[model samples]
Structure formats: C-alpha cells, structure tokens
Target chain A: DVKVTQSSRYLVKRTGEKVFLECVQDMDHENMFWYRQDPGLGLRLIYFSYDVKMKEKGDIPEGYSVSREKKERFSLILESASTNQTSMYLCASSPPYLATQYFGPGTRLTVL
Target chain B: SQQGEEDPQALSIQEGENATMNCSYKTSINNLQWYRQNSGRGLVHLILIRSNEREKHSGRLRVTLDTSKKSSSLLITASRAADTASYFCATDSGDDMRFGAGTRLTVKP
Candidate 1:
C-alpha cells in the first residue's frame, strides 16, 4: 500500500506570517501535488513537482511557493499568510504515468 | 474554470440501495478517476477509466466513461453506510489532474 504523510493535521498562524506544509510519500512516486479545497470551489491546484527541483504552477499559485529538494518530500510555503488563505490543504503523490493518486490526510490551516 | 463538474450536489439513499453520480468535463482527458473522501479525511482512489475504455468495475463499484460526450458516471451497488461520503471525479489531462465539486452522498441505515 502507498502512504502519503503530511507534517501537520491542523495549523494556526497570524496574518503576514510564513507557513509551511510538508508532505512525504513512501511509494517513491515521481509526481507530487498541493491543492487547497474549498466548499463550492472544489480542489484547486496550487503547485506541483514532477521531479526534484522541478516545479509548476497550477491554476491558483498566488502567494504560494513549493520546494522539492528530494523525491520523497514536498513542501508548500506561504510567503505571507492571510485570512483568505485559511482552508484545507491536501498533498498527493502518484507514479510517473499513473492516473491514480494517493493522498495524505489534509492540513486544515487557519490564518487569523 | 474547473475541468469537471459533478451533477446532483447531494444525494440520499438507504442501505442496500444503489447510488449513482454523474460527472462532466470540458476538455479531452487521458483518463478519469473517482475518489471518495469521508468527512475530514483524505481522499481514497476508487476507480479509474481511460479515455479508450467505456466501462470499468471494481468490487461493488462501476464506472462508465463516454469520451465523445465528455462525461462519466459512477454507480455503487448495495450501498452501505460506510459509503456515505463525498465522491469526486478527477480528470487527467496529461498535465495535471483536476477535480470536480463532488457529490455528497448519504446512505442511511
């Protein structure tokens, strides 16, 4: 079975603070993704990494950056957290050509 | 715009009954997948159907895709209370996977 783990299940931060959400996968998948899910809005991609040091912006990447220094780990960074950034963040990983994705328990972020 | 949209935002059914959901996408896709998410939990991959395939089955779940119509449907047979969750359809466009708003299903005992 594939396992994807997130660093934090819940987090609270003040406005303008820098926040980091980490994800690690044990399946050695080549693709990893970060997404924020909101009611009625669905899961919108924030960023994705196809390989180490390779990153691509998704539909909504504003105020967010990602790091993939290693194959097993992917980190999402919020340059300046705002109240609007409060939402459930999910991390997923999949094989290079597979359509199935294994996801980690999401981190519910609260930016006050 | 989201690549996929699920019909019937919410559904309620009794245990032992069947539940069906539909999804429509705007663009061509390499494959379509169905995922289930319990309340406050991560998503679990349920099934996947490639563009060239029309129907696929996994246990009690059945998925059918129509490339010409750009749509897909998922059916759960003999549903159990454990099947109560949000079901999402994701589209793989060879670049990134996009998910729909999801259908919230409630299976009452």
Candidate 2:
C-alpha cells in the first residue's frame, strides 16, 4: 500500500504570515501535486513537481510556490497568507507513467 | 482551466438504491478515474478506465468512458450509508490528473 502524509491536518495563520505545508510519500513516486479545494470552485491545482528540482505552475499558482528538493518530499509555500488562501490543501503522488495517484490527508488552512 | 466537470452537484438516495454520476472533460485524455472522499479526509481511488477501454468495475462500483463524447459515468450499486460521500472524476492526460467539482451523495437511512 502507498502512503502519503501531510505535515498538518489543520492550521490557522494570521494575515500576511508565511505558511508552509509539507507532504511526503513513501512510494518514491516521480510526480507530486498540490491543490486547494473550495466549495464551488472544486480542487484547483496550485503547483506540481515532476522530478527533483523541477516544478510547474498550475491553473491557480499565483499565490503559491512549491519546492521539491528531494524525490520523497514536496512542500507548498505561501508568500503572504491571506483569508482568500484559506482552503483545504491536498497532496498527491503517482508513479512514473501511472495515472492512479495516492493522496495524503488534506490540511484545512484558515487564514485569519 | 478545468478538465473535468461533474453534473448534479448533489444527490440524495436511500440505502440499497443505485447512484450514478456523470463527468465531462474538455480535451482528450489518456484515462479517467473515480475517487471518493469522506468529508474532510483525503480522496481514495475507486477505479480507472483507460482511453481504449470502455468500461471497468470494482466491487459495487462501475465506470464507463465514452471517448468520442469526452465523458464518463460512475455507478455505485447497493449503496450503503458508508457510501455517502463526495464522488470526483479525474481526467489524466499523461502529465497530470485534473479533478472535477465532485458530486456529494447523501444516503438516507
């Protein structure tokens, strides 16, 4: 079984503060992604990494940045947290050429 | 730029009844997948149907894909209270998988 673990399940931060959400996968998958889930907007991709030191911007990557210094770990960074950025964040990993992705428990972020 | 969009945002059904949800995508896809998420938890993969394949099944879940129409449907048979959750359809275009808004299903006791 593949397992992906997030650094936090719930987090609260003040406005303009910096926030970091970490995700680690044990499967050594080559692909990792970060998404934010909102009520009507659905899960919008923030950023994704295909390999170590490689990153790509998704549909809604303006306020978010990601790091993939190693194969097993991916981190999402918020430059300046705002209330609008508060949403359920999810991380996922998939093996090379595989469409089936394993997800980690989401981190519900609340920016006050 | 969303890839998948699910119809009927919410559905309510009684136990033992079957539930069906539909999803439509914009561009061509390599595969389509169905996933279930319980409230605040992470998503659990249910099934995947490849581009060349038309249908696939696992346990009580059945998935069918129509490449020409760029759409797919998922059916859950004999749904129980435990099956009440948000169902999302994801489209894979080789590089990444994009998900739909999801359909929230409520099972009445």
TM-score, per-candidate, Cα-based: 0.98, 0.97
Backbone clashes in model 2, listed as residue pairs: none
DockQ of each: 0.82, 0.80
Best by DockQ: 1
Candidate 1 structure quality by residue, lDDT tens digits, B10-68: 99999999999999999999999999999988999999899999999999999999999
Flag clash pairs in model 1. Answer: none
For model 2, what is the error of residue A54's alpha carbon versus the real structure, in angstroms, after optimal superposition? 1.4
Question: Considering just chain B, what TM-score does every model have?
Answer: 0.98, 0.97
Tell me the tens digit of each residue's lDDT in model 2 across A37-87: 999777888998899999999999998899999999999999999999989
Q: Give chain A TM for each model in order.
A: 0.99, 0.98
What value does the TM-score of chain B take for model 2? 0.97
Highest TM-score: which candidate? 1
